[model samples]
Target: MSKPPSPILDLSHTGLLIAAHGSPSTKGGRTSSRKHAETIRNLGLFADVRAGFLTEKPFIKDVLDGIHLPEVYVVPNLAYRGFVSTTKLPQALNLTGEVTERITPNGHQRVHLCDPVGTDPSTAKTFAVRILSTMDSLKVPDTDTAIVVIGHGSGRGRESFEHTNRIARDLSRFGIIPPVFTTFLEEPPFIKNWRDLTRAKNVIFAPYLISDGFHGSEEVPRDIGFNTKSEIFIERLSHVQPNEMNQDGQRLIYLPPLGDAPEMAELIINRVRASLT
Candidate 1:
């Protein structure tokens, strides 16, 4: 017996709009979102693919207004299903629910709103691969190493904190790496207090964010004990071999955000495909 052919995905009649929380001061946020759109555009699945931001030019509202496709899918390119993804983005797009239909110049239009990429069940697995690869490159062993997954926790709701902790827990259960810890910029057990959370000799800081925006590029580095005088400073650190610091034999390694990860494009596509079902 032979394996059956894989199912074909066709969305030639639909348009995709990636809604993101952009930063005017940092280019990484908008740049990553547009990069994802470009990656998906080359695949030619959707009739059109474009990225829109909340705090940048070509805003979400304008992008939605320009799209005239019979069907549209709005996927929030956010890290967590927090206020930005579930509330701000939806309100900007005027979405009533998961599926919103309205009369427009293009006749009857249907729009599907997808959950944030980070909320996908497979996200934890993708994240694990990145962490394992990073560790392999550093020649670091799982013993005596603590992994801290940091997120931009929200005060408005517990969604951000909950999702971050869940991902951290899931990563820990994999047993491939050392103990995984959850920290945040806007919540308790903050990134600045990593020493208080765990006692691992070697520490790895992984940012659980979509992009190296204000939080990732600026706050993360500062919290992890680096001088973030400019956004480009963090980029330079990423290129440094062993991007770690030694203090009395203890080591601290900082990993970049997941925005540039190749797996992210797949995660976005999975979110869109799930909406179709």
Candidate 2:
């Protein structure tokens, strides 16, 4: 009798680590990280899916140190390539090489650094959909409401702000006729200028961020002259009581962060597969 054929090993079943800037508050504070992992697992894209974070406790290094995988790909859950994507991430992983660095610390496990989720063009399209959907749900007039996408803008690198601007521009094609502008956390046309950027009396504040952490929860509202009660303000404005708007102003609605949309997951998986080839 002929010998039985040996089983084939599928190297594509390598492990995937979805890393993000984690949060300290709430359960599974790494919301985006977990969502990306789940999306990958749900799509049957990878054999193993794990999560890591930069901020908060249990940094990426700590998480990677405990996990065991044949080949690990550190995919940032962030939208753009800023400090986290450049210096902090590489140093945390002990990586020393070029942009697409592949480092094997102690020659044990191989780790590959993949492009951030924001760099992918597909992300722009996904963001467009999220903004429109939020507008629809809030019953805001697409033609009258000004959609503002808030990003963690950087002065050193224009990539993050550029990506955000592209996303806002892309959203215009969706028939939201008023205007789509972008604001930043570190750059000009800051949050304070939000009221002046658009002519729409009703504003929809949508964060172009991945998590509902400090920037989304605290800083954003404080910058706008309100407190952590931003959601309350948004809800109250949705109905637009006659007395709410000041003598020279109109109501403003703040939407939640665009965290781990299904389309975002698709974009990430596609980017990773493309990078591998």
Candidate 3:
């Protein structure tokens, strides 16, 4: 009875699940989840790390059923949209308005669900790092570039859009760069208005989504006049080739969705650890 030093945790008996509301049309979201799950599994953190989805094959219930451990942890792999974080995940996992759902088989299976992992304030720092790195790669000074944190703002979940703004504000206050903007695909001050509203000559666009699916990669880029092919967006983390683009008078830099970044995998691990306390 000694704990493995690899994961550095005594949760060898536990199974970890990274849960996402996967895309039905595009495999990007689910594929990213599986990639991250594999990354976590390589870390030897739990008995197993599995990706579960609400819309794709290998559904949440399927993974839940397959995990034959007494303690199972499910981390919501979402951007903290009110719908998915509050309603969809709970309903799909059959929590019945509880923090966890218990099932008794041989002894018992205690399934603990964690909150939205991507939209946590901790990710603000990660976003800042990504922006800085992108700026460095483009040879653009951080102070000279404005950052816009983009989201698929939902009117049904106004809180989700507000959270996007909060991340932008945090990035601004944290001094990643001044002139931070928050815009969306489905709401006001949208992507089309990026040039009109933003004060900087160069802008770094960062996605505040779980995956670079249809919206983040293709739809958003197309709206911004990049006009990339839809098929390429499905598997790409960074949609626009060559990173930076010159749009007449202004410069545009696209950063991959946070969910696709390695930092996000670390954040997911942190989320699972947080649930332990």
Candidate 4:
């Protein structure tokens, strides 16, 4: 005869933990984490939502230890798959379940590693829309303005830059002819030749980045010049702290982080639900 559904299934509790490459200099990292947590909380889907880090202060161990939830799902807030996403995060969290074959430390927490946000198509669309909107705000004509998608280009893994380039290429189909070029802190073009790369006098500098930390605050401006003569749009995915902006005029507009966008929250939820099956 058919028996009643297992009682153990009813006792199961699900949790979500977002892991990011944490920042020590600026509070952007924490802000992103908080926003993700809040989104999950607002949805009321999971029993708990927590945040962890791969580097710099409040390590993964701390986050795992702090969580009271029994079963947890860890979503890496990283854009690309690299040391942090592939090795560092998994090693630190010691996650095990349907994904992990063997046992490791912190195995008590049923942790599932969700793919990085950047890999999601929704994220790419969101970034593209934001960049385009930022350019529109600058009164930079689509024909004249050249959109430069500045990413933290790296020699280690081409994934980071490639993802940005892919987004740019996809958005190009929408008639945004703004030339999308990529420069790196470690690679060539070096943010110095940004103007030369795209011969458009009206250039929209959008950092295809998530946070406004070292790269966003100092390096980007230092090399590219803080001259607001040309429109500058910093496309970040985290909230902008008051100190980050010194509003002189509308010449330079630091658009809100992609995380603040409700679209992002929807993307995260969709990603989670898709992975469940």
Q: Evaluated with lDDT, which candidate comes out highest?
A: 1
Q: Which residue pairs overlap in candidate 1's backbone?
A: none
How well does model 2 score by local distance difference test?
A: 0.67
RMSD (Cα, Å) of candidate 1?
3.7
Tens-place lDDT digits, model 3, residues 91-133: 8878765356576565678888776787555788887777777
Task: Tell me the tens digit of each residue's lDDT in model 2 across 8-86.
Answer: 3343556777778887763473365676677667655566777777776667888776656656677777878788887
lDDT of 4 at 20: 73
| Candidate numbers sorted by lDDT from highest down | 1, 3, 2, 4
Clashes of 4: 1
lDDT of 4 by residue, 1-277 (tens): 0222223232236777777777776674445665766766765566776766666666777876676665666777766656667877877877543364333364554556777666677666777777776666556676655666666777887876677677667777655676777676777767767756866556666666654455665567656655322333332323342112332322333444344454555555555555676
Model 2 / residue 170 / CA error / Å: 2.2
Task: Kindly report which residue pairs in candidate 4 clash with one another.
Answer: 237-258
Candidates' lDDT values, in order? 0.80, 0.67, 0.74, 0.60
Residue 122 alpha-carbon offset, candidate 1, angstroms: 1.2
Clashes of each: 0, 1, 0, 1
Cα RMSD (Å) between model 2 and the true structure?
Answer: 7.4
Q: In angstroms, how far off is 104's CA in candidate 4?
A: 10
Report the number of the highest-TM-score candidate: 1
TM-score of each: 0.90, 0.79, 0.88, 0.77
Deviation in Å, model 2, residue 163 alpha carbon: 2.5
